[model samples]
Target: MCVEKTPWEQVIDFHGHTCPEIALGYRVAQIAMRELGIKPTPSAELKVTAQTHSCALDAFQVLNHATYGRGALIVEEQGQHNYMFEYTGTTVRVFITINPEILDHLVIPKDLSSRREVQNATLEAIQFLLSSEESMFCSIQKE
Candidate 1:
């Protein structure tokens, strides 16, 4: 028999890399869905607004099927990692904020242009971010 990977596992595969933001995006999407009492699916009802065009947005698209092409995801280049998810047909919106303090603790290499080096550093940082617990690095609220 064959086994299928979970949505998040598939997200990591599709993203070709893992980082704290990706994990945070996945968690944020879940929190939003839970708030709306909706099941996870590639539906057109959920809307995602991201403040940056980073791996987190990709994770949101892959895991939750919220993307620009479907008119459900919007990206604003604010250089921040804050995310907001709103379900259509309702006024509910869930905002997720990533703590800058957590990023301050990470040691980013100077040569960010090197793909291999950056990926390695990102993987390591993601591991630490995951173990540190969500409350330390992010906060989610429904509005």
Candidate 2:
């Protein structure tokens, strides 16, 4: 008799004032998982605790080329929290709790030109990751 191992559910939680940023984070994680060849449990809801510096650093490193100089500085602290993940059966759910301090760190530049540049760069990185063949196997669900 052969016993089957249950699939693992992957979950990511992003907590931030900027909805777009949180959504982008979700997309990035989904893509990463796809690249790694891991299948997320169909309906497992995972409670992702907080977003740590390591996670931010990882994103910065990967998106540095795309963000140019804008990516170098931590314009927004985004707070210090964990990403909680929980798996039950075939479903996966993610939760991201944002630290209030993160809002205080948002720096509004004087010029829109610089802001646009950074935005464009970030968009490029997101596009590149989403379009890559490696992102085909990952599934991202926001909570």
**Predicted model with the maximum TM-score:** 1
Compose the digit string of candidate 1's lDDT tens values, residues 29-68: 6666676676444443778888887766777788667877
Q: Please give the TM-score that candidate 1 achieves against the real structure.
A: 0.77
Evaluate model 2: give its lDDT.
Answer: 0.36
How accurate locally is residue 27 in candidate 2, as Cα lDDT from 0 to 100?
46
Clashes (N, CA, C under 3 Å) per candidate: 0, 25
What CA root-mean-square deviation does each model show from the true structure? 3.6, 15.7
Would you list the C-alpha lDDT of every candidate in the order shown? 0.74, 0.36
lDDT of 2 by residue, 1-143 (tens): 97653211111222222222433444444433333233355553322233454333333223221122443323333454334333335344443343344322223333547767767655554454334343242233443
lDDT of 2 at 80: 48
Question: Which residue segments of model 1 deviate by more than 4 Å?
Answer: 39-44, 105-107, 111-120
Q: Per-residue error at 32 for model 2, in Å?
A: 10
